[model samples]
Target: MAALGQHAVSKVKNAESQLVQEWIAALEASGGTRNVKGDELKADTREFLQLITSSLENGAGTAIGAAQWEDTRQFLERLSRNRAQMGQDSSQTANFIFALKGPFFALLQKEFASEPQLLAEQLLQASELFDALGLHTIRTYQASREAVIRRQQEELLELSTPVVKLWDGVLALPMIGTLDSQRTQVVMESLLQRIVDTGSEIAIIDITGVPTVDTLVAQHLLKTVTAIRLMGADCIISGVRPQIAQTIVHLGLDLQGVVTKANLADALALAMRRLGVTFTKAQ
Candidate 1:
């Protein structure tokens, strides 16, 4: 009974010491913002440190979900020194790296003695965590990156949706971005539905915002034309800029047999003529 009581007391003291160290580390983690480059990066690093400490406390580093952080430490050490570093977001990673060292190594030498799988999983998470926090720290390729990712996701959602008609029978789709295969699918559906609902034989596709059309864009356009034809409508490719035409030819991509016009004016004129609305073209 006496021996067990002494062991328990020792454990309690160690636990108390660990708790004090954690608060100290947390304070330091928050204070090291000067060495960090940006306010956003500093905030992200601080948040990541909190998450690491939480995970360690949860036995996530020593138990089945615990990650082996040896490689992560070495990786962070390299990141800390590299100015031309590809992994800058992880620059302050070292600050939080050694914070959990004592507990992890103690657990690593014994707890994970036979649980290699848990070690592997934890290592995987460490890598993922590194990346999630890494983006915010990078100096180069930083500013527009966040916005670009956001726009890409938004554009992807937009592409999956069909076009809505503003008129009773006439259909109009104003495209703003590149027409990739994924987005082209949405555009095709919208055009087809409008033709069926209004019994309209003509659809005007305005592409004033499309910067350049590559092979994929050309393929998407072809697919749209095919779908519109099956729906019994005449599809017009409008707003074909001079530079876009040159790009199409430079790529050696064939867009032959597809109806195209110099601008929406010419396209609408031809569509109106097809619908039996004839107008005199002045010489």
Candidate 2:
């Protein structure tokens, strides 16, 4: 790709304010100004225009991957990420770059009116440069969105698995939702960490909120029980509704070594008995 002509660079530098105003107008017309503040938009537009002019003056050609365009690339990347976090989609983010095309083309046409060939060359170079930058913005936006989603998923996993201290030397983990390998790992880690932290000898896993008991869920329960024993703590499986018990029996799943109770209250009672904790009824 050819370098942007000096005439084009000078045109942008001379008419920078007009070009920014026109670009911002176009952006607002396209509904790209919904989430962004006016002051922030003006500052970003000014900075971007300055970066573009400086890059063109420094011989940064249509190939934005060149070392001379690194600053411009970094600026666009930051802009894209910010827009993504602000809930702007890829099209809106890229529009922020592409909106400048009309204002710039009008400037180029007037600057090179007497020379059509030079005008076309500069226009083509400018188009290529802006297109490349817009594409870079979209790619950066997608990556940032993916990062945000992954972080939210991690937070959800942590929120879904909560360990409670039921009594002295007793802990309870109330699980809801489907049990997958990823969720199972989170459950095991949270429960084991609580056991170590509290020095609790007994753990009650209450699955009253869990919708079903399948092989995968049973395996996850077994894994949690094994982990508890490894940490020198006993685990009782609770919330074994009649339907779940029937399902377990129908599937021929063996939970022989694991102690299970029909409800959380019974599990708590048994756990207290094993821990030798006694309570008296009030008159």
Best by lDDT: 2
- Would you estimate the TM-scores of all the predictions? 0.48, 0.96
Instruction: Report how far residue 204 has shifted in candidate 2, in Å.
Output: 0.5
**TM-score (C-alpha, index-matched) for candidate 2:** 0.96
Off by over 4 Å in 2: none
Cα lDDT of model 1 by residue, 1-283, tens digit: 0111222223423554453355345536655334445654444444444444544443333222235434333343344444223333433444344334334344333444576775555445544444433442342234434555677887776664546453445576778877777677767766686678788777878777788888878888888888888777777888989999889889998866778888877877777777677668799
RMSD each, Å:
11.2, 1.4
Model 1 lDDT, full chain set: 0.57
Instruction: Write model 2 residue lDDT over 1-283, tens digit each, in one string.
Output: 6798886798789999999999999999989888899999999999999998998899888888998889989999999999999999889999999898998899999889999999998889989989999999999999999999999999999999999999989999999888899999999998898899999999999988889999988988898899889888999999988999999999999985899998999999999889788889999
Model 2: how far residue 149 lies from native, Å: 0.4
lDDT score for candidate 2 against the true structure: 0.92
Instruction: Name the 10 consecutive residues with the lowest summed lDDT in model 2.
Output: 1-10
Which residues of candidate 1, in runs, are more than 4 Å off? 1-63, 66-166, 193-200, 214-216, 246-257, 273-283
